[model samples]
Target: MRAPAANPREPRRHHYVPRLLMKRFAVERRPGQFQIQAFDKSNDRVFATAIENIAVESDFNALERDGVRVSLEAGMGKIESAAAEPIARIVQGGTLVGMTMEDRAAIDLFCALQFARGTGMRAQFSALAEGVEARARAIVGADARLDLVGDAEGMKAAALQLIVGSLLEFTGRFNDKDLLLLQAIEGEDFLLGDNPVAMQNARQFGPYGNIGLGVPGIEIYMPISSRFSLAYWCPTLLHQMREGAALADQRLLQARAMSVVGQGVTRAAALAALPEIEALRARLRRIPDGHLAGAAVAADAGNVTRLNSLQVRWAERFVMSRDGGFDIARRMIADDSAFRQGMRPRLD
Candidate 1:
């Protein structure tokens, strides 16, 4: 494990401009800072030079003032009506142009939220929020001639959506309701970054043959760290998806696969996969008597089967949407007698 930094803010967050886009600029790494010589692709002329971690108070003040001004204008109803039309245009144009306005908006919104919450990715995102929309438009416009379904253009769009989705879930903006909406909007097979089992399966299965061959969509694999982060924010969503009837068999299979992966990791390997286990542990801990003392005891005793059962049951109750199996899980966890006697087998 990496040691914690002395200063909580010692390691400043870094934002990577993709290489495809970076080629449009001159980039250099100085001793303690990085520099970018950005150019306007339209005119092929230098536009600006950006040095990382360098910002003046006025820069932040300007952005803050803009945010405040917009808010005040909206509240006063001066901008509210005008905002809707432009927003609708952005969404419609973005969809038809294969530009992900929602994704970019999510990034900008989350970054602002983080800054407002004093978590401080403020410098990084404040700068990004300035030109993100323009950059996204440039990218989409440039890639427009390429295939929209499975080409590099499509990959970039999917990647952006994945990143936005990951960030939203990471920042606690994702919820069970969001999951339901997402499922309805994008179909059940939409790649959920929080679903480690499904993600791992995708990696193991490799890119399906149909992938990139003109299928309507493609799955984008997210970094394990992002999925791990989801455990903190969307345990409820995870629980709902895990036990919900919508993707029951697939979810169960993925859960089992995750368990197997957890069992197989070596200490070094375990460090990497620790997040997923931690997520599982975090989800389990939501239940009464589901902490280290109770669940850990079973784990330490080599009762993997029992431990897994407990985890599944715990998740089932932690966010039971409707009755069905949920009621049984709830009763099993709530009733001391049932808890001590252990969960019963269902005959129905």
Candidate 2:
């Protein structure tokens, strides 16, 4: 008798930070692993770390210190060191904490779509969207039976719905007031205005401000997972600032705009769509299992076009109000070139 084969869809290893992070670090490949080092310019210190691809057991000790121990098992990874409490708090209920390698890839695919939009490049955005659809098709086909042509559109819809549904599921786990505050804090102009102190104070006492157990200021540092969750539901903004604006400033504006839109969607409208999200997930799960052969590749070109159209429509419909403190913040950050452009549409 032969042993069973491992799931082909599963990745051989997992990385908390993607390879892009290497851009900020000096990396050296050694035998089977990589040593990464970063120099902190402000502190004049060097930090070094190593990573490697290795088989992780379903359950195993990760780290231990001062009689405290952390473990990773069954999709859940934890750190119990008192010194690591901050890390623990930030990641406590993240979708990534317990997710398998394959699922992480799916989530990352969706994240890439968000990042692509942040790039303010139309071509990049379309490419990423098509990539996501193609990946989703491959994963779905591998796990289930389906007719590519007959169900390609349906599958694409299902994939989008699944992304949104999963995000809703995560949001649903929190209380209403907490959810509301989370949305507000994540807003682009939340901390901006004439009175920065007053704004900060307001956030400190907001509904979800003191909610994170034993984690002071947790609201200010939302988990990366939440960012992606919001990204899935929002449209990306284009960089329409006038020429001569600093590229770095434009990039920051794009990021903040993306955050605002993502957070904005979490309000009443998203809550009202909870039932629809559930239905979408249910429908996605009902698809039969089998390989769809070349269906995934066949739909790539069409999906790219569809994705671009969807993004454009979403961007057009999204309007940002200038009455709030947001106007002041935008003007403060805008370069002379951008000011002349006169408030190009807010990404959110």
Error of 2 at 123 (Å): 39
- 183: Cα error in model 2, Å: 24
Error of 2 at 345 (Å): 38
Task: Spell out the clash pairs found in candidate 1.
Answer: none
- For model 1, the stretches where C-alpha displacement exceeds 4 angstroms are 1-28, 36-48, 52-233, 244-348
In model 1, the Cα lDDT at residue 205 comes to 25
**Backbone Cα, N, C clashes tallied per candidate:** 0, 6
Question: In order, what lDDT does every prediction score?
Answer: 0.27, 0.28
Q: Candidate 1 on 243-275: residue-level lDDT in tens?
A: 543344444445556656655454346455546
lDDT string for model 2 (206-288, tens) is 44443221233221111121111111111111111112224434544555455456466644454555455545433332211
